[model samples]
Target: TKTFVEVQQRLDDVNSKLHETVSGAREIKSFVTELDELEKFDQVNDNYMKANIKVHKLMSLLDPAIVLISNLAIAAVLLVSSYLASIYTGEDKVQLVGNIAAYISYLQQIILSLMLLSMIAMFVSRGEVSARRINLVLRTVINITNPENAIKPGIIGEIEFKNVSFSYNNVNENDDKLTLNNLNFKIPKNSIVGIIGSTGSGKTSLVQLIPRLYDVTSGEVLIDGVNVKEIDLEYLRKNISYVTQEAIIFSGTIDSNIRQGKVDATKEEIEKAAKLAVADEFIEKFEAGYKSPVNQGGANLSGGQKQRLALARALVRKPKILILDDSVSAVDAKSEALIKDNLRTLKDMTVLIIAQKITSIKDADYIIVLNNTGGLDGFGTHEELLETSEVYKEIYNSQLGGYHE
Candidate 1:
């Protein structure tokens, strides 16, 4: 919020400055105020703090360097020309020396100009160096690894995690403890598995392993009986469609963003998927229908609209496995019910929904409830867990306390 307000103020100042420039009035006050506002905005990112300070220091010294270089060059030229004229016309050389001296004044201006050009060239070299350094930082790889001779796995959507253990940077401890401790699990050929947990219960991390977003520290993640690391990375990802809490939308016609799921998907298929996700009603109301240009990150759309659109994009693919990581949290209860209702009839597709809301997955065939300490607290259906699992009962009690008479 602070960043947004600061940027808005800076933008308004910039607009006023632009108007001043166009009207032939170069207000020094406007430029200074704009520069100060920009400095405040830069503090928000802190991306170039060190480089900015160094650049400012260099700028302070640049004028003196230019003056010294100019003075030295002029002194050299004047000394040389004065000596030459004196040697050529001994006491009668006043007029000749004066003419040469007047021309020698231009020599200082030429030297200053050359110094300015050199400074510009130095700035260009620094810019290229800075660009190379930035590229080097960006090139550092994390989880993405593309292997040669990668073969595609068979069409079975069986997911298996074998003793998978994961850890992050050991800021406090010298050793890395497992966030998912010696975990072993398997999803059958065609079954919807619901993963329920409190916030930061390693739900996201566990699912991320199947997609190879993050590799297991000690074990293997398998899809379709083949380890994900050994399978063709592209083909493995192509068979799975994932949606998360934050819906990523691009700026373009709604049709274009949905096409990213399956580039060659027919219009009929797109419309069908939209209908299934209950996004058709709102989309049809737009003047351009599917062609309505969505703003970047779907800023032009409501949270519910973005979530539904993302769901529709996921459904359009008709992948072997649908991994939804709290994807419907933003949608309204009615919309969520409609989409879930449609999902009941889907066959041959394995759906894995990771959710925090117990009401969302109460009817799921299998619910794996996770505790805050990164271990499975319970695993069963809503009624099954309520009867047999204490953790599931607590979650149910917490979310639907009033409903319980």
Candidate 2:
């Protein structure tokens, strides 16, 4: 059973890789030589085929072994009974025959019981392996959880990070390697803060801490002057709406998907959110309008459309804090500008925009610049950063095609 489990795992891995390869076959053909790509695909295919063959072979042997054992037991019982009956005289022979019949019946019953036991053993072995896998998942301890006396803050959107540091590895806090180094920053209430950095600069990691998605290795993230770890988990998350870089849509009507943000939202409110996100224009064009069906993961929608819908979903919630993690990258410049304009109307809510493009965040109230080494380079307005931060200045010049001065 252990051997079968290991083989099954390998087969699953190979099948998953093969599915990915097939889905991206066009891209592979465009970038890779045909022969080389075929060889790689064939190797994975061979592994799957071999695993399948082995399973079939095992089934064939097991079934035949059970049948052969049963047949042999029956033949041995009959042969012994026949020989005993032939050697006995008149009355003795009759008694011997009756005894032989009883013995044969008992032997048959034993053989049937053994066959059933063999089948049960096979099933039990597989069930044990499956149960162990499920238990491993069930027994896993969640690293992030609400404290015993969690606070529920009355005020909503003031955020601060004090001398914060984080590492993916929880052990060895003294280790030199960290995803986010010691950092401190404050985002005032009802303000738009832009976070910009090169790849792997911990931009996402920093925002994730705001919601306690991960606990800081050291220092603290505070909300409304209270340590975030002390805040109730549900209360903290309910006040923040996060739209990730990749828009995730469910298999349902557009109305149903948007309603996920605010379950009891009215039709008017949903329409208002779509307009704010600049999604209503496209949605109205569809014959079904808001009732249009969205396939799984929004595969039926274009990238920009999916992003617009996600933005609408976030806006519909009227959250105290909204975080956009490169959510508008797929939208055109005109649409992006309109969305930014609409965001200005959300005066009571604090907003955080993490973007790669400088143009997307140039007009933000304050910009937080991070260096490649996971340290803060600057935190100020665009003009202030251009003058004071080399990293910010270089990025600005590269995107705008000139020196700020």
Candidate 3:
């Protein structure tokens, strides 16, 4: 069992290393670190080989030892029974022969049983290890579940944070290490809100709260006058669309990927979404159009193309609230402008754009400036921020370098 566990652990490490090496192959070549990566892979592979050999060696010894013990027991029983039968001929030779035959038969049965156990020992050890690994995941406590009577809400896209605070780890609400500390804001329905912050200022964390991805450590998050925790998880998520910073693409056709947003979406809806995201411009050029196959992780597409496709997926849902977490950062300036203009036309849809560049959200209805200390510095229009927030002004100057918006 111990040797089997070692083999499993080493195999996992080897697989992890292989994935990392393949994913970052370009970086390795550019940095001229091929030898270093190869060395790392070799080390893990060697460990896996050694662990596997140990298991094999143990099995080799165990099988032979079991067989040898069984054979020795059978030999002793036969030799002793035959000798006693021959010597005790004075009393019923026929009865002594019957006893010897019975002893031999019993010994053969025991040997067969031992051999069967030896054959299945490898399977038993493997099953034990696999079961233990699976049980760990099954035993994890689920921290979120639907209430007894979960509300299926009719959403209008208004969002509010009332003294909300959050921490990834277990910590007090008043703890300084909170990711978002005591946030208070109320966004009207159909408004374009821009969230900007220095890196690690909890911009993503704050938006994630709207969908109840993580329940607040303290306070409440309300959507359309209802506490988010009271709403049905699936229903609430259906009304919200979130495009994360890293666009994830699965192995499938472009149409299939987009349909992930709304499984029953019509051809017209799909085309419209593609056009709105400006993805149709490139997709139409493909011979297969929407039927074009996308490689896993979008290896065939450019960074900008992947981001545009992800945007199209989000827009296809036509949700009441759209959250773009620096999603347009990879696209060209013209495409970004078009995307922002299209967003303005989505009636009654609340939009939150988290951007690193001030120009990305210069015309936003409201701009939220999150300070490096993990709290809001200001929340207002662009002009309002320029006048009030030192953080905003610094960021603006650094990016624009005196260029007018």
Name the best candidate (by lDDT). 3
Model 3: per-residue Cα lDDT at residue 288: 100
lDDT of 1 at 289: 99
Q: How many residue pairs clash in each candidate?
A: 0, 0, 0
lDDT of 1 by residue, 1-405 (tens): 223233334455556655555443345455656566456545543534444455556565777887787777778767877787768766567666776667667876786686787678656656666566578789986566867778886767888878667766422222345566566777887788889877877898888888787777777888877888888788888888899879999899889888888999999999988998899989999999999999988979998899889888988989888889999898889989988888888888888998888888888878887777666777767777787767777777888883343
Of the pair 2 and 3, which is ahead by lDDT?
3
Error of 1 at 303 (Å): 1.5
Q: TM-score, each model?
A: 0.77, 0.92, 0.95
Q: Candidate 3 lDDT (Cα, whole model)?
A: 0.91
lDDT of 1: 0.77
Candidate 2 regions with alpha-carbon error over 4 angstroms: 22-42, 55-83
Can you rank all candidates by TM-score, best first? 3, 2, 1
Writing each residue's lDDT as its tens digit, candidate 3 over 1-405 gives 888888899999999999999999899999999999999999999999999988888778876787787678778877887787777766676777777778778877887887788769788998899899999999998887777799997899999999988999969987889999888989999999999999999999999989988889999999998999999999999999999999988889999989999999999999999988999989999999999999999999999999999999999999999999999899999999998998888897999999999999989999999998679899999988888988999999999885346
- RMSD to true structure for each model, in Å: 8.3, 2.4, 1.9
- Per-residue CA lDDT of model 2 for 101-208, tens digit only, reads 787788778877877776777677767877888899999999899899988887579999899989988645566778888899999999999999999999999999
lDDT, model 2: 0.88
- For TM-score, the strongest prediction is 3
User: At residue 187, what lDDT does model 3 achieve?
Assistant: 96
